[model samples]
Target: MQFADAKERVLSLHQQLQEHNTRYYVLDDPIISDAEYDRLMQELIQLETSFPELQTADSPTQRVGAEPLPFFEKVEHTSRMLSLSNAFNREDLMEFDQRIKKATGLDQITYVCELKIDGLAVSIRYQDGIYSLGATRGDGQIGENITQNVKTIRSLPLKLATPINLEVRGEAYLPKKEFERINKQRADNGEPLFANPRNAAAGSLRQLDPKLAAQRALDLFIYGMDGSSEVYTTHQETFRAIKKLGLKVNPEWKVATSIDEVWEYIEHWQLERSKLGYEIDGIVIKVDDYALRTKLGFTAKSPRWAIAYKFPAEEAISILEDIELRVGRTGVITPTAILKPVVLAGTTVKRASLHNEDIIREKGLLLGDHVVVKKAGDIIPEVVSVITKERTGEEVAFHMPTHCPECNSELVRLEGEVALRCINPACAAQIREGIIHFVSRGAMNIERLGEKVVILLYEHKLVSSVADLYYLQKEDLLALPRMGEKSVDNILSSIEKSKGNSLERLLFGLGIRFVGSKGAKMIAEHFGTMDAIVHASEEDLLAVEEVGPKMATSIVTYFKKPEVKELLSRLQGANVNMTYKGPKIVHANDSDHRFAGKVFVITGTLESMSRQEAAEKLEQLGAKVSNSVSKKTDFLLAGEKAGSKLKKAQELGVTILDETAFLAEIER
Candidate 1:
């Protein structure tokens, strides 16, 4: 084709792709099939490759991402992207409205209530009707530049409807279904599962390769303009203008004339938010009129004109049928409440952990009693409280069993411990649980080896210990029920692959009492090898940072077991990794590292990285990272809306560092 013909074709493809993207992503209406869209995209790529001069920065082909970046450059936000103060109940909302009314001197005020998307906050700048830059809200003022990743969001138009130079703020999110899809794939690959959609979105956006972010099917909802201007008189009008500029805006916003109307809107969404395509944590109420917002100006941290009303944890009432006892790998006997199937937090929860005998006693829980069940932030479902008013005479008070449910061994509550533990090493339940834990996602991460298969192996006597997992023969596995040749092959492949996991994973998988993943990592890095850690005395274990007296004792006690020693030897015989494989552990004695040897704890919502990421960075610098604020904690890295840890650190005389200070220390 001629150069002019190619140019025209490229332009046409760009227009077509943009329109289709808007129709599918923004309007949720598609006139063409996904195959047709892909065909158009392929044609555009071909044209761009054939005639390189015809390609522009604003071309639809750019949405596929550019080269991987070495590191993200920092960009200063035009306006500080402050976090909102939260209101948990109607009284808090009333107080907020009263405060606004007092400030603006109005009896009743108009406010716009929008869904508080559970996503990463981001901003995009458009110059002369072209998308110029995109960034995270790092420390409110400065942020990591993610222009390439932002450009990949097909919902974001590369060029505006008009030649307007302005900045827009939005929430970048992964749709719920897409989050599920990605997590399912990750699970199948034995990768760690994302905790939530918000986490998945944040992880995707922070990828070094923009192509990875593009593949996540991420989207954005433009909410606000960076600065107040005469261009739009009201907040709602700005949404209209944003839509007119070909930007996607969330359509579920409502204008409330009174605080009661605002409360009504919040009430409606509190029950309906889960039905939406993306996650919504709460509702944000903002002054609609721009002049009123100007009059009722900013606080030190957030705008006084707006308040976020956070939704409470979803709860459902279910009748407790019976209390069952469970044995952990550590032999801890935990009581689980079996409830009548009730849909709670988008899942049918039939079982909830009663936690311990003490909890049961404290709550006066009884079988046949109605209980309030809730998920502890989508992690575990637990019985929150017993509905005393719903109780009848037929309710039976639960008591802890004297003997282990599986082995019929006497259970004992160890010194200074609330948990009732079965000390029987030969317990069948303990062995099965241990093997299951060893292959779990955060441990050795053996893919496709689920709980049922572990139980099956145990029942058939095909495996008695976690070490047996590494030595599983294909013939034995193939002989098991429901085990196809393909299934057995994949399981064996995963088992073989897990032999090279870092020492920390193996340590955690051993189910040592009081030794968590972080503690395992610290111990592994400090000792450098499994042999060193296995033979280390309590004094040697104490040398490692984050190892408290109790933890040191637990490690010594766990390693002292003859069976554990034998298991370690068998694992060694199978050629499992016996040394730390993460970033080289630095020396605290090094002169240039000020944070070295210090104990740091982190809390709240960090804009740049997750808590785990920050902890790993600190560990690399030879600083001990703890999860709680204690007297030994040297610094508390507090982020947005820092809670009890921040207060506890202050009370304990621990030094505090903000996100900026923490980042500076790490960078150094």
Candidate 2:
């Protein structure tokens, strides 16, 4: 074929594939079957291969790049990505109204309320309608470039309806079904599981491999846009414009002219949030007028005109069936309450964390007793209190296990911590839990090798260590009960695939005491590879940002173990990749700010800024921001409608600051 003809055909293919992608991924509606789409993609790939000059970054085939990067490049945002302050109740919403009226000198204020999606905030830039850049909201001013990863989100438009420059911000989240499916897969693979949809979405977005991000089946909801070229009079108009541009936006938003209407919207969503496929922790209320938002201005962290009304913790009543002791990777014995099946929020609750013996005793939890259960942040289920008045004589008092449930080792409470721990490192339960953690979604994420399979493998002595997983044979897996050929093959394939995961996943999977996923990623990026990390001294680790003395000691101690050294060697021999593959955390020197070294709890509603904005300002000034008020809290920044947190702060003798005082202190 002539070169000219080939160029025309390639252009056509690119347009067709992009449109198909938009329909299938973004719209969740496809005109063609998967097979048909594959055929077209194959045709485009062939054409591109033959005419390499015609290839472009926007091509569908470019989703999975040739190699993962050493680290992400930092992209400074055109505008700061502000965080919202929160309101917990109706009173807080009314106070928000009062603040708006005071600021604008208007008796009544109109507010646009949208779902506060429980997901990662991201910004996507488009040039002349074509997608250009995508980034995370890293510290507001600067963010890590994730353009390739964002491209895989089908709901996001690669090209807009109009040829205009735009920067759209949205929440990238895993739908409830997808979150459950991914967690289930992780559980099956005997991997550490994602705590919730939000975490899963964040982890998926941070993946060095865009292909990995794509497989996560992520969705997006574009809420607002940033750009100087376009103007919209109101928030509702902007939403409509975003929709017209072929971007997905949540439909359940309302414009309330009065605080009562705002409360109405909040009340409706509190019940309806559970019904949505994705999680919404709260509703974001903003002044409907863009002019008003501009006039109200932004604080260091959030827009003063906007506030998120967070839903109260959801609670339900259930019967406690029994108390089960579960040993962790660290050999902590946790008493989990087995409950009669009950629905809490939108999910079924069969178990709730009893935490420890002290909590169980404090709440007088007894087996077969009726109890109140609640999900903290709508994720973790825990017993709130026991319904002792309703308890019959048949109910039995609960007891903590004297020995580890898995290893029969004596359990002891540590000097200061509330947990009862089994010090035996070689405890079978610890080993099992460790392996499960290693394979979790946030870790190596080996699919299909789940809890039952891992236990089965261990019982049969087919696999006992994380490294042993690489050495697994198909025939050995096939020997297990109900293990079919297909399942064995799938597990083998997943295990092989995990070998390509960057060091962070492996590091997190290792379950180093006191090291979390964020720390693992930071350490992995700072060190560059597993070898560098293994050889890193305490001083070297200490130099890394966010690494404390305890964490540094933990790393050094963990690596020095002969078993760990050998395990690393085995993983190396098995050809697992060990290098860091995401953006390195840049260590910027902290400037001395007034609130430095203080601890803050932001409660109620602030007039000057959103709760997040206030927290960010406090954090910027070197203050530690905590969710709950405690004895350690230096100050409770209270606003109107301050509830339990305020009361708790008062009881704890924590200092309280009004919004005016908070602003004054920060400014001073």
Instruction: Name the top lDDT candidate.
Output: 1
Please provide, for model 2 over 1-668, each residue's C-alpha lDDT reduced to its tens digit, 9 standing for 90 to 100: 78999989988887888788777766668999999999999998898889899887666777656455555677888887776776888888888788888888988788888888888889999998888999987546667788888888877767777888888899899999999899899989999877668768877887887878888988999999885214878888899999888888887888888989888888888887778988988889889888788778876446789888877787899999998888888988888899999977656899998888899989987889999999854447999988888977999887787888788888898898999999998899888888888887778988787888888888888877899999998888888999999999999999999999878889989999999875786688889989889899999999886699999999999999999999999999999999976543433245466566777898887776888568657755667777877658878887755555754564344666767657877887
Could you tell me every candidate's TM-score relative to the true structure?
Answer: 0.63, 0.57
Least lDDT summed over 10 consecutive residues: which range in candidate 2?
582-591
Model 2, TM vs. native: 0.57
Candidate 1 Cα outliers beyond 4 Å, as residue runs: 32-39, 187-192, 316-364, 368-370, 378-381, 387-395, 400-600, 603-663, 666-668
Clashing residue pairs in candidate 1 are: none
Off by over 4 Å in 2: 228-230, 314-316, 321-367, 377-382, 385-668
Residue 232, model 2, lDDT: 76
How close is each model in CA RMSD to the real structure? 8.8, 15.0
Q: What is the C-alpha local distance difference test score of candidate 2? A: 0.82
Which window of 10 residues has the lowest lDDT sum in candidate 1? 644-653
State the C-alpha lDDT per candidate.
0.86, 0.82
- What clash count goes with each model? 0, 14
In candidate 1, position 626 carries an lDDT of 80
